[model samples]
Target chain A: MTISTMRLTGVAAACAIFSINAFAEDSSLTNPAISAVLDGYYQSAERPMSERVEGFGLGHTEVAMSANIDDMFYGKLTAVIEMHDGETELGLEEAFIQTLAMPYGLSMRAGRFLSDIGYLNNQHVHTDAFSDRPAAYRAFLGSHYFDDGVRLSYVAPTDLYWTMGVEAFKGDNMRAADEHNERDYKSTGVYTAFTKIGGDAGINGSWQAGLSYLRNENGRMTAEEHDHVAVLDEHDHEHSHSAQYTGENTYVADFVYKWAPNGNYKYQHLTLSGEFFRVTDFKPLEEEHDEHDAHDDEGKDYQDGWYLSSVYQFSPHWSAGLRYGQVDTQMMHDDHFDPQKLKETEVSLAWHQSHFSTVRLQYTNQQGTNFDGIEDDNVITLQYIMTLGAHGAHQF
Target chain B: MRINSKQFLPKALKTLTLAVTLGFISNAQAEFNIFACEPEYAALAKELAPDARIYSATTAMQDPHQVQARPSLIAKMRQADLAICAGADLEIGWLPMLQMKSANAKVRSTDQGLFFAAEQIDTVDQMKSVDRSMGDVHAKGNPHLHFDPKRLLGVAEALTQKLMQLDPDSTAQYQANLARFSQRWNDAIPRWEQKAKPLNGKKIIAYHSSFKYLFNWLGLEQVADLEPKPGIPPSSSHLASLLTRAKQGDILAIIIASYQSERGADWLGERADLPVIVLPMSVGGNEQSVDLFSLYDSAIDLLLAAK
Candidate 1:
């Protein structure tokens, strides 16, 4: 089917769902708050970008339902629907139950949910000022990370805002390797801890800073295995594959500052945010034939990346944003791949028709060194995000 | 003899818990911590509980409906003994998020620690059915009932009862304060009405339903709204249509709240040659509006000047 036809069908289905929800007669306090986000984008570029598809495509869309289970518990479930390579795919994004009234400012959540590690990690993509997350997130976290986990968080009693949280996850989704190897974990694989502090800068401004750490019990990440494996190139030619680097630890530091006239965000505002990521204690994995050659894999490896972004709302409906990100990856000595560094810069303008809808136009330029001959590319994209039904409140 | 480490740890924890509980009990008796979603409620709270430590979540220069659930608010909510807000979905956007994130068992929607000012009093403009397409309508009613003196007295009575229930030790003090405030407020209401007598039957344009109760109380008519839809901004096409009605010269003035952007009202005022008046919506809305009494005085003075 044509892309336009598919888009029309998707929109029709969403509207139908909304009408059914609106007309439903069953009203009870236990009934969940239902909402849906519809996201679509059109891109023009010479080559497919890292996180963006070429031409017309449906982006990340989600339907979520949430309710307080009782006075003590709250539950939420979100299902993601998107187009991948001209085919529609559906997946569960989040399903969690959190404590509502834990004493001493403590709360616990369990089930599959996004880890609260960085400023932008747990927030929905539809709430983002830009069409995409920064390059650091795309490279290290595969855009957004969610897994089966349990989390416990505590808010301090002091006047200044401070929170600390810990999480444990089954790392199947977070593992860098798509194909499992002998070193794969059997059970709980990823553990994380994070602390955040924030306060009002003034009547018109607020600032928050956070530090986070993640440890992978089993192998954490895999880089290109460039040694002996042969992989087919996009041009239908045989090429050496990239090697794997099993990471043990990752750290993230993030900060955000927001300002508006007299704390009023209805008209004009500015947001400045940045995040830095580092991966350490990485050990390159050898191919199956060299399983006994563990001595060669003992060398430690490291990688780091960071991104900075600012968005200014010039008027009630229009906002412009600029972001720059860079990532450096260290690879083993090989013929197919060398240590690579990628830098990306993005500028975007968003028109918020209302609180529920946004149309964004963005331009991105990426520069890469030792990136399989695809060094530099410029891409432009137009995207729309529309919320239907009971849109929930945004969190900081 | 060396103490067993495991047993000693539990003992230490117990002591810590007792100390913290004692500290909280003492603090509660000394001063009740109150979290008010808006400044008007904070002013009301201060009247009833003079010794209470009050925190207003939103400033006078903020649209309460558009407040962000900032971390500082969550922190304040966590420490509050009681939360006072104009419910009826006025704070639906951010209050629930704050309540959940605070995790302070005391202040959930169903908890006694939470009080809704609008729910305690009758409101105007209630609807049986509502939709977002209608632009941010509340199914319960217009939530900006604080401007109506009669309804505000009802809220004050209900809030005094609530505060007494939460802090029973200060019930006599609360009753005394309520009596004094109600007497003064009742007296001032008539004076305000007398001053606003000139505004009766006068027509004006407004930005939102923020002053619905005020208009109803003063016998004023809202001829038009700057916004085409309740929440939507005024478009050029809608403004152009309003220009025709504006030329009829029935509109006494273009009125906007202190927190609202004046662009739309200014445009209409310029084109129609009408007086543009910015009214203080609540306490602390302007320098002169330092309290509830001053708030009403400032609002009436501004509207009278425009008239």
Candidate 2:
């Protein structure tokens, strides 16, 4: 057998063994709930599969197992299988143990988990309203920020919902600096603080707003660097050169307003949400080598982006939404590279077949300034998402 | 001289206000907080602790299977001295998160402050083996046990004991309230039974298994369910078969809760010339379903009206 195929088999076997062990251990007294979600899409873009921003592809199939370990703790593990660079890959998406009974309204969580930065960052892709991530999220947060970390959150004792949280990560996020493979990155990685407040606006309306700040001491390009190189290849040919970055800070503010006409969501309802982000002081580290001459005089990089989306549930089973997103980046001083702006507008129609299944059709128009100058891309995606077993309901 | 009198009047008003505020503060201190996962439990808590602050996470118009986690729910759960829920997985979707977020020691599952009504009674429709094809079936059995009046009384009795355990000072008040509630409930059950005598052995269709306890109590036979499975939407083919069966048999009505979709029931009702009845599955489902007693009254009244 091929080496890749053998590796896939090994990973699959390991996942099976782990899941069986968990079930056997928990099911004796209290059975751990098992759930799986399958997502697929038929997508077409104006450009070729390799050159286009979108293409027909198989999305990830996720398997999740979760249960309470004891009275004071709960454990969850989710694994995903998907194609990565023409090779089948299996990865652990989340594995965490959270405290159920903590003092002073405080809860602690440890393990690899998604960051609670913006409204949609904590939600899975399959549960999102659109087929693709928003342009702001893609450019600012690298689509979604998942990290190995520890978090502590405190819900305040107030009439309105108020929560404050802090997270420390291993600095392995692709958007963060992790240049030295031999270095102990967790000690000097990413740290985040966030606060959220929400309350009912009136009889039928409810709203929530949150602000988050994240600091990455040293940011290094990992796999996403390859995509940047690919974009650069469209203009000038630059041979394999590695760049190190330092002092990256990001700020995000998000808000959501929902009106369900007297708290009844079965019929007509409207949800409007928006998020804005800004990143600053991400500069390439200066090295002693002459090969780094190209970026020696360049100033720090700055980026800002925002997205707004609204969904209207016209009926019990049917809903439609529209989103507008834009990202602007101020690049280093260079002749071939200039400050670029990208914008995307998307419209989607979805049908909730049941609580466990959904079918969606989305159309997106992307207009942006890339390495090759101005470009426009139109994409259409028809997607289906189905869930089996038990999946927890999403937070508002 | 008039200005001096006006200033004196202002001081008098301030003193009165402070006295009233203190009185309210003492009254609130004496009261306990109760957070119920569903409206039926909130209504039951009213009978046992009429003066306790009550909060219901979900209303009758909302689906009990799932709910959005709101800030108010967390705040209520955090302050609750007693947390009562119809917990055969009825509030499984949001309750765990709410409990964790609340971080209130009293309401933890292991604590006596946490009470599950389903644990106090026997449940039906429990699956020996569970699968997705069964469509969101609860492995712990149907959690809609409030429809059975007897089970509700049993749950109330247990809840009263829990309240007494938590607040010994209120023991006498809780017992008195329980006695009054038990008398009224016992008296009302027979009247409801007499009114529902014609519904015995009546064949009916339901949108979901939500009415299982109700059917068991009324001796109504659920001939077929509109949904293909527990949570799955009814397919056209299944609706077609139901239509044929409705025409062939003596079907009373197509019954559905206020929160459920009526498309399948309406389609079957239109073709078969049978009435589609929207019943108040719990309290506050409609105007007439103002409380637990009226919830049953409204449901039975709807059924009898359909006939």
Candidate 3:
């Protein structure tokens, strides 16, 4: 391997080892966890520069608006035009709405959305605890997990614990880019619960756990999709031609442990949070010519991922934080994935300027067979948040 | 913390995004209950919740700290679709009393009947606590977190969330209005902060704990209060104590609101030989302080002005 490749691999390996070591030690929160998640849609409305903070299939021209109309409602509307170097449009970046107004910590949301999958899945631009989202989110969901559907969510009320209710679209173009895959729409999911006990030091947060099931007519095409059957000759290439995924069912079980103690004045507190997501009991089919056969990987192919991060607030005006992310999955293969064994590590840094704005800079040194055994990327972001009106009521 | 006539109407109220939204809706057919705790929320309700039945007991200049057992407020609370108040204990003294007595099955802390403006608005004086020695202090930080617009974001959010819930029919309308109003409100933040920034760290005295939060916002140093206890007026020894501390402190001014008595403030100011500026604490107390922005505008000018 080239010197540069060797160095990169070395760093990635070290990160993996450090991540494992970190698991052995407890996290320390220094900032408030109950902090504003800013979705800074960067824009230079009047500036002449064509590119300021725009690059890498991201939008420089993004618009975001937030408002607290009264004591009961708070929301933000975001829309962006995305493209490359000088291309007028690659597509739209974000077209989503987050409305938090309902009795019992329940929020009714509709519009293009980001799949609230793993920890970093739906972390908005402004609200991202770290500057950049994890690679798993990008690889799995990409820019758009676009699927139009309504979602109902509720945070169960229990001191030092968590409970969530979610019903969302089971297709792509949901929270990422809005795209349509000709698959029969499906609605399948149940609520999940979370708990984090023993987080009184005002540093360690509570824990989280939930059970959910989902079903979908996931395959986009029917048997008449094509007219060719391939007989495989042991080589894993496209030796045997066939549509691998016909129809499938999916389920997930997730859990998280946190020690967030922020939310005081200036959020000058700390928090340690981590979560795991596991998939299970799903089946798929492959078709060629006129015959049907089970997909290469069927009968309970499970994949899972998790991450642990810590944030600390020195004062309300200023804060600093660090987060580590990991992912392991084998959804497309023929075997189940033991999430605990597969690993990748990411490190991050963040600075909150105020309640509404933050600047996060992060570096990820990942290894261990994830990302095709290569990992080297830097993500930097500045997030801003603004709300006007009475201020959403939280006295309840 | 200053009194003037500019507040007769705040730009915030006159062209409220909520009010204008009312005009935009061709269908003005729904009726709802609006519970206004402070006169300001009442003022907004009058404009935006015009069709809704209005409810509130306090006026613009009354002592929120002293308002008690008003049957009218209770009746209003009982039938309120929304109970909006300057939260953070600003209305605790009276609201809890009213919430208890009205027995409004609908307006519980857990229901739509309860709305905290402070919660909706970003609030200040969050960490302050009352002590036995601090006269007229709200044991829970400065209940006057409403004095700053930055804190107002919380209030607006809470208000928006509640409005959307209670008036689900109006969610879309409320959202649009909220977005526009928030735009305007946010637009005004930098100007307001700049206007108030100069008064940081100024030393002043007050008749009660009324100025704690306002002082905090302006970064002012409070020297003392005219009253010796939470509800008690200044005593002879209290005056004596003031006399002793007056000379050493760089006391620049003394703030007294119109609803409060002038006797205690006058004596204290006379002793300190400083301006006994009578200020308006809420809307309608004075013309300049009638509107929200002007209320703050006059406050800064009054506090920072040369004697």
Candidate 4:
């Protein structure tokens, strides 16, 4: 048997054991075991890849599990084991505990987690509708980027609805506490709630705005600043590259609107949504001396980007969409860098085969602000989807 | 105590409070702003809210699995009193985003605006396998319950109950409408059963497992699926297998949906001299199937004509 098949077989046995254990312990577990087994089969690595199927992607592997310990508290632990040439690779992906049945729509979560930015950020391997995510996500959001943090979410009641959330985390790094004591950093973020108003006014939407702050320390660089007394009459100075990767502040906001007159009209299926994100990292510079003994101080460079997308469905099964997206990686295209901006325009068309399934095709063209020429890319995809078990809310 | 008594001295204030309370109660019965995330619920909404404007972002012609983060749909959901959809991974990609962006407090989880199809309909194609060989698949059995009219009736009932609760003042109207619909539907069941009796026990091949419910309704034997698995399309090898099966008289004709590639079906039909019937799974799927009732009528007529 293949390694993946063996793994699934073992997991199936383990699930059987878990089901047996549940039945042995509490009759109230219900049919969750069946559901678990079904979800597990898709997430497991035993599935093969071929042309006729959604070819299992390359460089993707995950092992994560979450459990509800009691009524109020729940915990999740996941380790993404990377495979390079069939060898064991270590990576800590997601580990956290959350309050499940929190009071009054207020919930608390803490531990390592994948950051939420665009759609498909929090989903696992098996649950994804398509085999891959969109371009904006792969470029802006780090592939498999997760940080240790705590999150607070609250839902306020009103026709003008409200949902507030905040999170604090250790910047982006895989280092543990013992590995780099001086590299400790902190990042904080706050988000305004989503509000709704006016009934059947042909305009109903949800919007969120956020601000963030981050900082880091490097004692080694601070020590390098101390000039030691030189024995020689002339101080022949040695040089070391200062640690440039420190901390930075960021701000982000996203809004979406779903308006249908009377909420049940055949023509009320129009929708519009967009997201904007900006991050500015503080740049500390060094002084350079020329042969003439003149010194020059370096300037700082930061990065930012935003995208706007819209889609309109004429009916329940057919729709056309367009997205004009551009990113000014100010960090990459700053004064120190060559390019000044990077922008892309993409268009998409989708067809819903059934309530449980859909297929989409997208095309994109890109150009650089710094005259780096241009490149055009085309992507065609067909997806088949099915859903069962517990259903969640519709993200408008 | 003296200060509190003085605050309540205005008799006009009491009258205003009573009027406002009565007005609020009346407004509570105005109507419900419901968003059916899937098109299947759109039919039921038509019956439950005949006067209420009904809309679906998706229609009968496309797949529902891969809707992107559409902004226009989100606008409707923000004002929607309730959001209903087929659970399972049907709308996983689009729905999650809709939830995060829908500003409507009522449509969010606590308000129970998220109504699940499997919760209301009798489901089928539930896999008993734990093996990945079964393919990267759905855990919630099969979510395609809408192909069956019985499931449609269940949705109608669920919609009625929900609408009555949301618009209590219109409870009598909604109940009366539901009774009429149910009675007509029940009365038509015998005719449908009689029409389908002639096609019973007929061996047929389907493009995918898309017609399981349809087959069950007609009492037809599902000899094989065009796709090797439930969702996967038929491969060249699988097509060869079908040819082998067809030659042995194990299968009669190949059934397929209009949206799917008919090349495979045509190829098989050409080789076996078996007739290919392009069946419409939903209203407006074909020129002849323009409405909910005609959708099934076209299906029954086509199947009967084939015999």
- Indicate which candidate wins on lDDT: 1
lDDT of 2 by residue, A79-155 (tens): 77665445555667689998877877888889978888888888787778887667667655545666788999988
Which lDDT tens digits does candidate 4 get at residues A1-396?
111112234345445445544553454653232212121112111101111112222233333344455645666655443332333343456677776555444667788766543334445543433333332333334322356777676544334344456666554331111122354432332221222222223323333333322223221111113234111111112100111112244444555555543242222255555556454443323311113222122233444556666666665456666766555542211223222355666565666543334455545455555322334433344333333323323443
**Regions of candidate 2 where Cα sits further than 4 Å from its true position:** A1-30, A45-56, A174-186, A219-247, A266-269, A284-301, A313-317, A333-337, A371-374, B1-30
* lDDT: the better of candidates 1 and 3: 1
Q: Could you give the candidate ranking by TM-score, starting with the highest?
A: 1, 2, 4, 3
Q: lDDT of each model, Cα atoms only? A: 0.80, 0.75, 0.47, 0.52
Error in Å for residue A180 of model 1:
6.6
Q: Name the regions of candidate 4 deviating beyond 4 angstroms.
A: A1-60, A66-77, A82-92, A95-111, A118-145, A150-167, A172-281, A285-300, A303-396, B1-31, B64-79, B86-111, B125-129, B136-142, B249-252
- Looking at model 3, residue B184 earns an lDDT score of 72
Off by over 4 Å in 3: A1-61, A65-76, A88-108, A114-123, A143-146, A153-170, A174-209, A219-267, A280-300, A331-343, A368-370, A373-396, B1-112, B115-307
Clashes of each: 6, 5, 111, 50
Docking class of 4: incorrect
The better-scoring model by TM-score among 2 and 3 is 2
- Give the Å error, residue B305, model 2: 2.3
Maximum-DockQ candidate: 1
Clashing pairs in 2: A176-A219, A176-A220, A177-A218, A177-A219, A177-A220
Query: Candidate 3, residues B17-94: lDDT per residue as tens digits?
Result: 777687557335435777777766765454344456665555545566544333344445555667877766666446
Task: Please write out the lDDT profile of model 2 over residues B42-133, one tens digit for every residue.
Answer: 99999899999898877887777757666678877877888999888877777877786677767986366899998888888777777666
